[model samples]
Target: MKSILFYLPTVGSHDQVLKGMSGVNRQNYRNMLWQLTEQARAADELGYWGLSFTEHHFHVEGFEVSNNPIMLGLYLAMQTKEIRVGQMANVLPFHNPLRLAEDLAMLDHMTRGRTFVGIARGFQKRWAEIMGQPFGVGGTLSDAGANDRRNRALFEEHWEILKKAWTTETFSHSGAQWTIPPKGLEFPYDAVRSFGRGLDENGVVQEVGIAPKPYQHPHPPVFQPFSFSEDTFRFCAREGVVPILMNTDDRIVSRLMDLYREEAAAAGHGELRRGERIGVMKDVLVARDADEAHHWAARGGGFVFENWFGPMGFTESLRRVGETGPIGADYRTLVERGLEWVGTPDDINRKIEKLVTQHDPEYLLQCQYSGLIPHDVQMRSLELWATEIAPNWL
Candidate 1:
């Protein structure tokens, strides 16, 4: 079980960001950058496999202020030595896939192969809807309505364009949502056209190629964020993209794991080892004792689930066994769920061991930097994870 540190990237704690008080100011953002750098440095030295951040925006209330994870990833790469720097997800429907391809290729050069990619379909309404309006789609929340259908169509289309821009030397696309080198457009650069492809003898645009390629062969490792949909599962298996499973129910995860392997075999990835190419993302708030862990959870991880993800309909995995409806009524509820390990270091280890021993996943991604946990508390938990919990698994 290789561990990856995940930063929800909330700028401040509940005390500093409750209600109308938000930390969108330059000074608060500066402090956030500093703290995040320190966290990245710690993870690098702690023998952790990788570190990641979420991609979010419009958090004026200072909850999950991860506006641009790729930019954050580049900065983290400069600060850390070994740990891989990447986003847990960059929403696909909200981006121009061509520009995204160029930025990532440039990042691969800058990071010297320390870069990875995590993709997701947009889920936030505020930014996702506005950003996607030009592209004829909007954010979705699993409602499975027309909005979801449109979002999925555009997301898949953008994904195809991204791959074409990266792997193909010169590619042309005529998809439902996009077309590279618009048919009527003409580029009559004589020096360029005289040299190679992209323009025809009539000086009409034919195809396009992204520059610099990538530091890693074809491209960096690609992963998709929390996948519950069967189509996403099959897509990941087919494309060899690892889907970080947020479904903590082993019954569901176990079945998905089997289904993933079955799909992989059909996709020509034959006979994988148990849990190969699989990842699980779990919430965690560890401390020396139950009381301290409970304290940490309320102000930090619990605040995130209740205030942020809860409204976004993402706290489903944190529900108690045999219970339904709204969750994270209190810290104890988060602790009771299969999705998180919020307790003493020993307690977390007990729960973690149960999962890994049964599933044996290749990657164990934890939400280490959620909400407004105090820096000291986060550091102590980091130490506990490095010294007490991780060694048992690694």
Candidate 2:
């Protein structure tokens, strides 16, 4: 299976705070950046497919503070030669469509076409509240029926505008949520109005599009990160966007892939091939022995389960899906349920092979680093994965 490293640049001290420590050490953000860059270089040299980053804001716990993944993507692009750099998702509602489109196009050019775009309707309520937009709409975990519908509609409108901006030379949009070059404005009404000169002689707004289109013809590959909604699956299939599955079981993934294939055929996109458009992410840890692997995986997994998912209300969601037996449990339980992989290289390879035979995923994203795992330990796990497990797939 093709492999990608899921990078979340969390400050080590944040874990201490989560554990109720009286005081926490302050970490230099620059050092974290340097470490991540180094890791990206290693992944590149090791022949990993790509590195995917997450986005968050106002997260004091530093669970994932990558507010601007495009900026990080640019840095990684410059530091590496071949591996693709991408965001697991750029929260769609949190950004201006035109600005996001332009930035992604620039990243594609800067990376020499080694850019991947993954879009999502953001989940964090605080972010939407800060931006004066409604949160928890459509497919969000906290969604309440109608409000969720409205939020999803807004996301769709914004996405439509972004796609048009990238693919069309001169496009005009009049959607419910936005109007480009907004109507009913005189040419010289405002100083900023004259900047783009996007107006006709009759004072009507004119069509506009991004300059320096993109390095990839049409655009770079677009991916939709995992969501439970069939609508998302159908949309990805229809648009030829790969779907990245995470935290879900193989049965669910297999069902979703079947749905995606059926939708693709219905949409005249032809039959979906095995291992072509699907990707899966799993928490992976490799060590000298099973005991060492379990110890570290338990620490990291428990921390993530409590600190990250607990506050976000995702633990209950997983319980509803039968992925977890209870909150605040031991990681061994999770491991037994196939939610995580922690063992020797042979053990990991066996589990991964089972997944590959069952799901036929095009890519397997290894989530090796998270919550309190020492940098050196994480690196060692990665090394083992590269030297021992990766060759089997090849």
Candidate 3:
């Protein structure tokens, strides 16, 4: 099975997509919401399997909206019936995990069990400063190694506690940043009760009882979004976490998938299957013709570089958050490189065919977000891909 995912861009705000487009004023902001909702509805109809949105803080980057992603997920859930609603990731480190967990649980129920969660240790210094956390000073003691270690440790500790909260009964946890009360809290009514034993009179259960049991058993799937990390790959395979690779080089994606397959076999895990967890992402724009595609992407992609890539310093933040060091190029260069695919249906199909043949990833994430592309243009791209491009593969 080939997994296909769709992203809703951040065009509501004038930061990225609306940079050069005329008529994108305040009223259009409200219009963008309705526009996205309809696009999502179309996705559900067109056989798209997953819908994802990116998360960010502040308005500096054009890729993010002032509205919370969880709220957007809920809205998408109401509009569509089958498509899996996802946050290509919601930043885990920036949020209170418990609140994040609760909101996700509610979203799962709201969507009739079509919720997927993506997590990342955040990498923005300015955002961290806004939150009053220490920003990693450049060329100081807090280099990439130190920062990665801190973030990795925090993620491990948080996961250990969170899984317990979600999958166990009456557990108590004590950590540097969090302390759970004894006697345990009541599970939400919707929470699944996971236990080897039976239930008691007071509707209370033992062994393991999670509040608001998720509609899906063993919890709705957990996804980790990043690129090219050996440790992350090993950990994901061991723990059954899906890894979402983004802005990744083609050769690296092939190598990583091979590595994952080898490790899974070496560890006595069953034959690794595609669409099971490993997925690669691509930046895309499709249009009626190659000229139109190039024109729009060049304009929109530049804004993304200026607002999000240039200012937010993705390269620096990812390095600090334990991603592999320095991105190795300028924002404009990277954006131009990614725009290698902005073309008409035939050109896109051929390029994607090569990627599919070469990498054979479980899934492909189309970049509809990440820059400031207008809602109409974004929707047109989605339509063209779904109607013209995707069907070839299907």
Number of the top-ranking candidate, with TM-score as the measure: 1
Give candidate 2's total backbone clashes. 2
Q: Put down candidate 1 lDDT per residue, 135-227, tens digits, no spaces.
A: 888888867899998888888888899889889889899988787888977878987676767888888889989997888888998888888
Clashing pairs in 1: 13-372
Please report the TM-score between candidate 2 and the true structure: 0.88
Better candidate number, 1 or 2, judged by lDDT: 1
Pairs of colliding residues, candidate 2? 137-148, 138-148
Candidate 3 Cα errors over 4 Å, as ranges = 1-8, 11-28, 60-62, 132-143, 174-176, 182-209, 266-268, 274-276, 310-340
Candidate with the larger lDDT of 2 and 3: 2
Model 1: residue 200 alpha-carbon error in angstroms: 2.0
In candidate 2, what are the lDDT values of residues 265-325, reduced to their tens digit? 8999888786578787777888978898877776675556555655675443234344445
| Rank ordering of all candidates by lDDT, starting from the highest | 1, 2, 3
The per-model lDDT (C-alpha) reads 0.81, 0.73, 0.63
In terms of lDDT, model 1 sits at: 0.81
Using TM-score, rank the candidates from best to worst: 1, 2, 3
